[model samples]
Target: MSRIFVIRHSIFAQIVVWAIITAATITFGLWVLTNATIQRTNRQALERAVGVDLAGMVDIYASGDKDELAKRIGDRLALQQRDGDVAHYLLADAQGARIAGDLIRWPGLHAGTSESADIYIDGTNRAFARSTQLAPNLRLLVAHEYRDLGLLLRQVALVFLTGGVLAMLAVALGGWTAAHRLAGRLERINAAFRQPDDAALEELARGSAGHDEIDELASHSGNALARLKRLAASHRATSDHVAHEMRTPLMHLDNRLVKALAATPDAETAARIADARTEIRGIIRMLESLLDIAASEARRGDRHGLAPVDLSALAARLGELYADSAEESGHVLQLDIEPEVTIDGEEMQLTRLITNLLDNAFKFVPPGGTVRLKLRKGPRLVVSDDGPGIPEDQRESIFEKFSRGKSCFGTEGAGLGLALCRAIAERHHLEIALAPTDGGASFTVTPEFQR
Candidate 1:
């Protein structure tokens, strides 16, 4: 039973149920109201009819012919009671004596000089009565029936029930149509997502757009597809660049090792061999950095490890280390850091991000240029270089894996520095922005701690 209900249940079902309930409530309410109104009006009409009959009875008794008056009253009662229109009749004297009528006595009567009283007669209770004065010594009473009013109300209730059922059917049909249309759109979107071919699925998802729920589903699907495509492209480009960059250094090292093995060398040649080995080690370090970036991107949310480190002190130290190099190169290196700005992260990765930015800046900046580093509040870091600035069009693309700007074409590095920075920032839920500078590039990093 539960499974059946689940299969049949939908928004349309709910709408139909609500409509039926509302219709039933309204129909029952109106039927009850109409019946009460009609019953009241019928009772009043019966009372007026009994009043007229009493007037006629008074005239008959006033004519000084008692037998004729009794006969006439009996005849009128027989005519009204024959077809079940009037149910019963009664007559009474001032002394509460039953003078004429089918019932021998009136039950629940109040003794007062009143003109009329409602009384139940025979087995069924459907009667009205009125009393009149023929003389001071004699009183006349008349009664009438009103059972047909109940039958009239029953017929009206039947009509209301029929109309309510029809209204419910109409509402149900409308709800079903609406739900079917909405569900069809959703089914199409789901099917598109399950398709094997990426391009075909994208086209199918795009084609669903119209002025309906299908359009909204299509829009969201398109956005998801675009993100997936971008991630895939970044991954491929990073892989290719890493392979090519590592291959060059490895080939040079291989050739140098071969030469070292073949030469009849003394101390100087041995020193040259050692230098080649160091250069190869530097290449290995750079390749490891690239691998770290790829790993970070692949598992951005996975917890690896963490340590507490002072970011501000680290930034100041990096500035000091680069200061002599900047002076010898005729550029100024300035640092402004707030103390005790500590955070929990992989210290090595953070240091690599800072080192990459500084190295890129130094490589691009000419003589008389400046590199500025600022860290504050444990959450914000700014690095600005007075070098050739990135063009507006290239700024957005420069952070993509292996995407190089004009100034970086001849630089001694694969273009993974900015990409790695971006991946690290994302892993920490940080915002990184590249801003335009007067004569160079400025980058701002806002960590999640600040938010």
Candidate 2:
């Protein structure tokens, strides 16, 4: 694999690359060492054979006459040649004259010492000679063909190199497979982080079934997710309690404001009281939206009592309910409904989601503009309006609580409508997105039903 691709994907691929490089480096080093060792051993064995042969020739020269010594050397050389051996022998007299041997000239050597030298014979065939002195004036030389030892070492090196390459290939293949599997497992865990919930967190643990490093990481992640869920549940309960307690006081305040408005005779004081009542009502609505968000989020991953909602009929009914309001706003209401689109979801939340979209559409579209509501075969709900479309930059942020677009500054909404819609859609496991359109703002909610 290419380095850029591997680096972009995962750490495992880089590790595999390093492992193969290290293996190759070690193998090359071993081959060099082994080749040197074999060459040294072969040279040493050849030197020992030459030493023994020179000593015997010296003994024959001392114990026999010169002719007998020459005769003995000639016999030994002849016997080796007959056997097709590459061994050569040479013995010389005090005057450095040619003696009985295949080698023609006497090699230069120090007396009573032994050393190896390169010698050529029979028209430039090279041999390795071990030269030894038999006396102050007499010398002996024994040579073996250099090609034999060189060829043997080459064969040994070739075998070792071939085996090492095969082993490296095998190891690399195995490591690549292992790294690929590990990277896939890690990717799944990483994806789980994007939508952190009990089911997604549990999925990581379920996938990591083997007793490996990835499995251990999954185990730890599952525990952390469990702890986080517990903390969230506790916080939600506290918020609900606080909101509930505050609602009673808010209701009492609303009642007192109502009575004050009734008792007050001054018109200016009544206006102030009515303004306070409206502010209080807005606060109550904001609090209720917060509570709804918490409740919808808490219902995520809950499967008990979930039923298939008829989205087509629901959209048609909601369209009828909002049609007169659209007409009053001087905007045409259009419904593109398929007959029987159904999905598994909470019916109340689905109704609220549709209601919020219709409300948003009517509030935004200019007079004489058209609002289109679609329910299709995929159980998808799309709400689009022809108006100054939502800005590209604000489409995503508009779904956040109290996040209003620049064009919506003068609008009457508290800005939790879209936020509530999002929470409801997520609770139903739906895919919600703001789609790009030529002349309007569009939102689509598709049910990601478990099938």
Candidate 3:
């Protein structure tokens, strides 16, 4: 019910409703004005007929006998009745005793007066009537029934009602069609924002030819996305340039430290030079990781040269490569790969992503602990270890670059491994999360399936 309310209150429904209301209101307004005009014209016609009849009867009473005058009035009434003119007449003494007419009694009224009212005659009917004292003891009343006018009014009402219904239907249909077109355009704009890729933005720009709110929004959004893409490319290029420029000097410094260590005669000075070389190597690795992170971020949603990558085969190869290292470290290594698991991605990036996760697992788990890799048919990849689990609070931040957990502060990892993995996972549209395990960390990667 709440969902229905939401839909009804939407712009499309509101447009349709307003159109129907406007059409109905216009239709009713015209109907009311026309009906009133027709009614007034009918009353005026009746008044004219009654006035002429009353004048003739007064002339007859002044010049002729009462009996003769009543006969003339009766004959005129009979002629109008036979012609279906809806007329009535009454002749009476001054004391109000009826002498002749269709009326049962004189409709009580002052002499020399004219008015429109509902009068009881053969039946109750609206009429324009007049009364006059033609002689000292003789009186006359003439009325014209407006029954046909009433019938005409009823017919007009019926026609107006039918027209109102048809108008409502026409307006509602037109309104809905227009609203549907507008809503479709808006939906296209929304879809562009969701995808936010070159192809989607181009599509949005192409659809924004119309001069409407949705079209304007599409135009604005496309511009914004293009700007963002350029900014991201510039940022990635800067990071790459910095990493490459620093690496050459850092490599030279490491080479000098190595030479100095070999030439030194003092054992303590040689050990200190070796420590400096080790720190230099760590710095080089950090620079390389930074370059990789930039590359991964820049490549997101990039479909160039993408192909179906066999995740199962890749995992198997990496498992074999890491097996010896895991065994030498006194840890049990396990692989449960589902056959023929494939995804559309860059094979090199996916390999790095998997390797980094596996390396992190191996680095954290203690001697005699277990590291297991699982690949399932859902294109789900899982790497788990029987090591200290990531703390609840640090699980989210653990994927951030250089954000190592407190427990692994002195561990071999510089914390770029998980961050790189996250970047690669986003590039492939995969959902990666740290699943809670009994006494260890469990990382699950579910690739977005192609339809």
Give lDDT: candidate 3, residue 85: 60
In candidate 2, which residue ranges exceed 4 Å CA deviation?
1-226, 298-305, 406-409, 447-451
Worst 10 residues of 1 by lDDT: 106-115
Query: What C-alpha lDDT, on a 0 to 100 scale, does residue 223 get in candidate 2?
Result: 71
lDDT of 3 at 40: 80
- RMSD (CA, angstroms), candidate 1: 14.8
| lDDT winner, 2 or 3 | 3
Cα-based lDDT for every prediction? 0.71, 0.79, 0.82
TM-scores for every predicted model = 0.45, 0.51, 0.56
Give me the displacement of residue 195 in model 3, in angstroms.
8.8
RMSD to the true structure for each prediction, in A, is 14.8, 9.8, 9.0
For each of the candidates, give the backbone clash count: 0, 0, 0
**Which candidate has the top score in lDDT?**
3
User: In model 2, what are the clashing residue pairs, if there are any?
Assistant: none
Question: lDDT (0-100) at residue 236 of candidate 3?
Answer: 81
What's the C-alpha lDDT at position 284 in model 2?
A: 93
* TM-score of structure candidate 1: 0.45
Ranking by lDDT: 3, 2, 1
lDDT of 2 at 52: 75
